[model samples]
Every structure is written in structure tokens, then in C-alpha cells.
Target: MTTNAIVTTPAIQRLATARAAVVKAAAAAQAAHDAHSNLLVKLADAQARADESLSDFRSGKIDEATSALRKAIADADAKDLQKMINDSAENLAQLNDASNGAMLAEANAKVAELYEQRVEEGSRLEAIISEIESKLLDAVVERYRVQAEIDPDSLKWMKIYKPSPALDELVRRGRVPGF
Candidate 1:
């Protein structure tokens, strides 16, 4: 699956079987990632830890690093980062298309219904995208509410957006997704 090698280095970072380093690196990454929701920030921290761990492992004196790096990758809130990425891409594309009526004029129906449910009454679209972006960010924030959270995703959590029963219906019918 990995077409390229996992490289690191003052030297050429080779993709060899360094089990201890690899395992430790994954754990460290997960721990760092768990602390943040912004994937870029999370992975930046993770990479720093991995780089340090790998460097230490290469030197054969990894005691102090081992304990801290032992956090299980499975414990990560987004253990399936790849899956989340795929889901986000697919969901975003579908929702965007529906909103723009690219698929069909009727596709807008789905988005309008969702808007009615999620957006506050009498709140007109702010430049067409401002409100939607806010909602998505809020939802993602809620997903990582333990740490990387800033906004409430649903009305129950805030006065900003209301819950959409239509959301449940769309999910039930597989009409719209990942709202």
C-alpha cells in the first residue's frame, strides 16, 4: 500500500522495517493527534514526536521516550484517519453538489431542507457560504470537543444552530450524508 518509503533524517530517511521505531512513532502520533482537531496542527505535532522517537531509536537509547510513546494508536479519537478523510471528502463533495444543484435542480431541495433545519430562522445566507462553513467547523469542533473545540455543532449545544430532524430523515433514507 505504501508506494514510497517512510523517510527521516540528517541522512536519507529509508523505509526499512524498524518495528520499535514504527510502533512507537504511531503511538506518539496518535497521542499528539488526540490533543488537536485541526489535522494539520495535529499531524505537525505527531510528526515532531515521531521524528524525535525515530532519532532516539536509531541511537539505541530509547528508554525515556518509550514510556511516553506507548499510548495506543487505537485510542486515538480518529484512529481511522484515512477513513475520516475519505468520508469527509465524499460527504463534502456530495453536499456541495447538492447545494449547487449540479446533480439536478431538485438536488437543491436536500440542501435547502438541511439549511432550514440547521440555520437560524430569518438568517439569510451570508455571502452564500459563510453560514455553511460555520456549521461544518462547529460540527468538527464538537467532534473534538474534548480539546480542539471552539464552537457548538448543534443548537442544543448553542444558540447558533438548531437540530434538524430532516438530518435524521436524510440519514435514514441515505439521501444526504454527513451533516
Candidate 2:
């Protein structure tokens, strides 16, 4: 109804929409952070086991056993170590891929949400313009109704500003010229 209200409605709507989008993006980032954290724990455990096995071999623990049995356990432990490394490598790769995917998805979602906001802002601005136009029409009608009581010049009131076609185009595109 009022000029300020008409001008601010679009801004308020845009702010609400942007806030929701930010919350969603933050939640996705947090999930990715937790997944990486879990992978780090697994990696640390694997590293500890590998280090302990290497220390035993370096300290002559293997030399104390009969050569055949020593060779067997050493081979088995080597295989175990290799398997652990392979598993860790695979897990790390998977973790990297997952985190990368999450980041990409979050970026894409945020971009999509921002575009949606642009559309919403454009629509809200259109509504505000419509409201202003309607209010101006009402004022004009009231002035005409009081034609006999008031001088035509004395009834002059503020006029509505025309919609900015360029601004509408810019907002729709979400950027300035050449972008």
C-alpha cells in the first residue's frame, strides 16, 4: 500500500530464498567433511600396522625363527602389508572421488539456487511494480471522483516511476553486460 512497502517486498523475498539455499549448501559441505574425517582414521590405523611390521623385521625378530618358517611368516606379513596398502589406496581414492563429487554437487546446487533467486527477484519486482501501478490508478480515480470539489491542479499527486526494462534484463541474466 505504501511506497516503502512496495519497494522493499522484492528484497525481502530474495533474502529469504537465498538464506534457505545457503543452509542446504552448508549441510552438504558438513557431510563431506565428516566422510573425509572417517577416512583419515582408517588411514592412520593402516599406517600404524605397517610401521609395526617393519620394526619387527628390522630388529632381527624374523632371523630368530627357523629360516623356512621365518620366510613363510615374512611372506605372509608382506602380503598382508601389501593388501593393507592396496586397500588404503583404494579407500583414499574413493574418498577423494566422493569429496570431489560433493564439492561439485554443492557448487552446482548453489549456482542453480542463485539463478532461482534471480528469477524470484525478477518476479517480486514485477509484483511491486504492479502494486504501485494499481495504487496510482486508485489515486487517479479518487482525484476524478472529487472533480467538483477540488481544482484539477490542486489534486496533482506523485506519479509512479516506470519499470526499468534494462534492469529487468540484467537481473534475468544474473550479470552485467558482456558477462
Candidate 3:
């Protein structure tokens, strides 16, 4: 009886090639997913920092405006203004406080607007990531379906063609050549 070395057929080569392509595509998709996830984390952190900065700015502006108004009122009292002037100065102080409040409110609204924009951007990124993941899954499934269509005997030969691990360590490491 004569024994011949097993030869790899064209179909087996194609299957192996397809599998490699699928693995590479999956790896690329994973990297992209990681990058998008990182972007989301960074965006959230930036939004938090921006919100804190806005709060600090509002607090500082209010404190400074209040301090200035108090100083003006004290100065007016020291001058012993006539009742009419005193009343006018009091009204002026009230107007200044109202103006400061209005400005602060505007700034707060602007911050809220900016926050909404960031949220929208984040949502867009998430949608893109989801789409990419779905496409990758489809590609993998299609590749597997194509592989399944190959003759079972040819598939078995392809499996046999894979290099066997010679060392126990290699086997323990789950290393398969051409995989």
C-alpha cells in the first residue's frame, strides 16, 4: 500500500483566505469600537468640566457684582445723600442687580445649549458605532455561510492541512498555525 501526503485543494485555500480576511476585519472593527468608546468617555469628561467651569463663572460673577453694589451703597450712605438722591441710588442698585441677574441667566442658557449640542454629538457617534458593529456582524455571518457551502470533505481536508502543534506548550497556548 502506498501513502500520499495530503494536498491542500483550491477550495481549502479559499476558505482559509476568507477566514483570515474575516479575522482581520473583526480586529479592525474592534479597534474602531474602542476608539469610539474612548471618544465618548472623553466627551463626557469634557462636558463635566465645562459645566463646572460655567458654575464657577456664575458664582464668581454674582459674588463680584454683589460686592461692588454693597460698596456703592455704603459710599452713598457715607455721603449722606438727600432722600431723593438716596432713593434714586437705591433704585440704581436694584437695576444693576437685575441686569447682572439677566446676564447670568443668559450665560446659563448658553451653557445649557452647549450641553445639548454635546449630547447630540455623542448620540451621533454612538449610532455610527452601532452601525459599524452591525455591518461587521453581517460580514462575519456571510463569510461563515460561504465557508459552510464548501464541500464538507474539502472542509475536513482544510482542517487537516492546518499545522499541528509539536510542543505541549504550543498546544496549551492554543496556538494553531494559519489561524
CA lDDT, every model vs. true structure: 0.50, 0.61, 0.56
Tell me the tens digit of each residue's lDDT in model 2 across 1-179: 65654543444555555556556655655665565565556556555555555666677664434444555565666566666666666666665665566566556656766677799889999999889878977876775667626665554433323335665576586655555
Q: Tens digit of lDDT per residue, candidate 3, span 31-102?
A: 555555554455455445545445555678446555555555544543443443445555555555555555
Highest-scoring model, TM-score: 2
**What's the TM-score of every candidate structure?**
0.27, 0.45, 0.38
* Model 2, runs deviating above 4 Å: 1-68, 144-149, 152-179
Global lDDT of model 2: 0.61
Residue-wise C-alpha lDDT for candidate 1, range 66-150, written one tens digit per residue:
7346333322423455456555556555555444443343334445554554564345555446777678777856655643344
Q: Report the alpha-carbon TM-score of model 2 versus the true structure.
A: 0.45
| Candidate 1 wrongly placed segments (more than 4 Å) | 1-37, 59-61, 64-79, 102-179
- In angstroms, the error of model 3 at 12 is 61
Sequence-dependent TM-score of model 3: 0.38
